[model samples]
Each structure stands twice: as structure tokens, then as C-alpha cells.
Target: MPDESATLALGAALWPQLPVTGCVYLSGDLGAGKTTLVRGLLRAAGHDGAVRSPTYTLIEPYELVGRQVFHLDLYRLGDPEELEFIGLRELLGQGLLLVEWPAQGRGVLPAPDWTIDLAADGQGRQATLAIQ
Candidate 1:
């Protein structure tokens, strides 16, 4: 669905079922609302902190409703092997992870519990969710 409401609704519906030890991969073009949907999820989880793409920092951590959530941006990742330095395993031990630009770490990253693809259309976005 390209509508913001529908995208947010889908995220809300899946909120309660999120596993404490799983990852969600977001695939989308620039300005496709990937961060927006993440913001929606964080808000649904009772988080009030500002949400921004971790493009430069590579990762951002948040505490939401007692859960440790990690948001990762692999855009700047020079090599998939570099993920090792970030302590991938240690981060995965956290409650949940939402990753953007996951292709950068294709083989190294864990199998995602859910994958979301988003595309820009006019002023809104089209979002698709798949479970793996």
C-alpha cells in the first residue's frame, strides 16, 4: 500500500507479534518512507525520541517500552566483512533490529524475520511486507 495510513496500519498490526530475537529488513529507494514506517513502529512501541536514518553512524539504538531496539543503515558499509567489527552477534542479542540497506551485508547478516519493501509513488509510498 502506498498510503501512509495503510503502511502505518500494517506495522501496527505486526507490532505485537515482533519477536525479541529477530530482525526486520527494510528495502526501499531513497525517500520511500522506510524511516517513516520505523518511526511509526517506534511510536507504537511507546517511544518519544527523535528517529533518523543511521546513514552516517551506521546504527542507532533506542529503548522503547523496555525493549532494546536497534536501527541499522548499511549504506556506508565499505565491506560486508566490516560488520564483524560492529559486533553483529552482540547487537542481535538485543530485543529487535530494524535494518535499512541490508544488501550491503548480504551474506553476513542473519535471516530476517520479516522484510519490507517500499517504493516512492507521487507524494506517498508503496510498502510490501514478506515473512521469511
Candidate 2:
């Protein structure tokens, strides 16, 4: 994608292709458009509220008309075990999960069904998707 808009468009296109219930890991550095893409997904899924990174909150839950989506940013996680306190297992069984900085969750997080990696490419960005 050449910019955030393009990245968001890609995310909108990818929303319907996503499984009803599964995990997606988003890998990218700060300002890499990870949250922008996630915002795209949420908007496509009928979310009209502001979409913000859960960097400090750790997780944000969105309950749409027909589905539930959880966006997690584990960047500041002190330890993977912290996930246990957040009902991670229960959420995995109920809705779609979009995890950013997934490595921070490591052993505590479930295996993702898809992994999307983003990076800076000049003034634009590059995205790679892997299905597991």
C-alpha cells in the first residue's frame, strides 16, 4: 500500500474474507498503520465510533450488531501472564481477535489464524499477509 488510505482499503477488502471467529496477528512498528488497518476493519464491520490503539488499555472490545471484535495491543505488557487476568481464553472462543505487537503476549496468546506484517516503504508502507 502506498499510504494509510490504501492500507485501510486493503483492510476493508479483507474483512469479509476473515473467519467469523479467529485470531489475526498484526506485526508492525509504531506509525506503521497497524491501527489504521484495524480501524478499517472495524468500520467495515459496522463500527462507527472512534478507533484507538489499546496501547495503554491493553485491549478494547467492540460489540457490533452481529459480531464481537477484540483489538489488543500488547506493547506495554509486563509479562505474557498478564493476559490470563484479561479473560483471553474466553474472548478467543467468542469473537474475532486482532492482536498488535503479538510477540509481547508470546506463550500466553493463542496461535493466530492469520498474520499480517506491515513496514515502512519510503513514504508509503508494505504489507504482507500469511495464513496459518
TM, every model: 0.89, 0.97
Error of 2 at 7 (Å): 1.2
* Number of the top-ranking candidate, with lDDT as the measure: 2
Error of 2 at 71 (Å): 0.3
**How accurate locally is residue 69 in candidate 1, as Cα lDDT from 0 to 100?**
87
Superposed model 2: Cα runs more than 4 Å off: none
Deviation of model 2 at 28, angstroms: 0.9
Reference-based lDDT, residue 60, model 1: 90
**Pairs that clash in candidate 2:** none
Q: Which portions of model 1 miss their true places by more than 4 Å?
A: 1-9
Q: What does the lDDT come to for candidate 1?
A: 0.84
